[model samples]
Target: MEYISFARLIEAVYLPQIIYTVIALTLSCMSSHRSSTSTELLTAATVQVSSDNQSPNSGNPENTYSDIISSSVHNITVIGVYMVIFAIAGNLMCSYFSGDACTIISTYLEIGGGVPVLYSMDISTKIKTALILSLTAFGGLSALFQSRDMIRISGLSFIKYTTGKIVCAFLCFIFYMMCL
Candidate 1:
């Protein structure tokens, strides 16, 4: 899906933050907190609200919003902090080198760093584009670890995820070459 690519397109520093929010929301919605039991609890809560002359879900907007926010805050904060650290570290590492070495190191460190480096390098545009595409498709090592950490309990294997990235990166590389 396009969103999956968006997830790996770490070029946008805020992409991971948004992705983490969506992921947390999705996981929370799929969680026991959102089960039929929650509906039943809501029904009981609604009855209590009705007795007090209030609507079901509409009466206590603050309560619902606060609950959602509180439940998702911890995970989102942790992931956001991690990403900030990632970006800072990548920038710091890139500061040590210039030219192609910087490009190579940054690309290896994070896909986000690769795009600018790819553009700044003295290489042919076609090669730069292909490499950038490959970096986005492969998502570098940081994304792999981030995704693995996020989905560790989802029954998806890291090997499969990495294989998928490789396949996608290879396909993108081929496509870029053909188009050029």
Candidate 2:
């Protein structure tokens, strides 16, 4: 679905930047905590590289490749866990409100799945359009949870991120109404 495709595109473009930012922030925090200057940190990293070059297994390409692969796997596993948690929470919330297990399950198929589901209902067009746009803007609790998990490591305030999302959603709703 278009939603899944868009999600993948967004993830591909933003996830690496996010991971890099987290790493940089973490290193910055650690350096500050230890009273180590950036120069010292750079020197330490250089020393580490030189030491790695001198290690017994340094000549083995397979070892280095496997290390890279393992780290990649670890990152993938963390992402998978985030997805699972998000799915579970979405299901719970959807069930509580809709009281229909089938509809709750199907909405996970795409970002705008709810639009089609809402269309089949007997609701008025105005209410349906409002709900569709609202859902599209909110992007579900799963997205919120995933984003929170991603940025939590950088010691960033989750409240600000959440507020931004809500504000964006509200603005989108307002714009939609103004157009009508």
Candidate that would win on lDDT: 1
Q: Which stretches of candidate 1 lie over 4 Å from their true place?
A: 1-67, 95-102
**Count of backbone collisions in candidate 2:** 0
For each candidate, the alpha-carbon lDDT, in order, equals: 0.63, 0.56
Cα TM-score per model:
0.52, 0.47
Error of 2 at 96 (Å): 4.6
lDDT of 1 by residue, 1-180 (tens): 012244433433233334545765587588875666657756765666567444376558897787678758966776566566666777787777656766565675566656686767777766676677777767876677667754544434578667666666766666656643
Which 10-residue window in model 1 sums to the lowest lDDT?
1-10
Question: Could you tell me the TM-score of candidate 1?
Answer: 0.52
lDDT of 2 at 180: 41
Candidate 2 has its poorest 10 consecutive residues by lDDT at 1-10
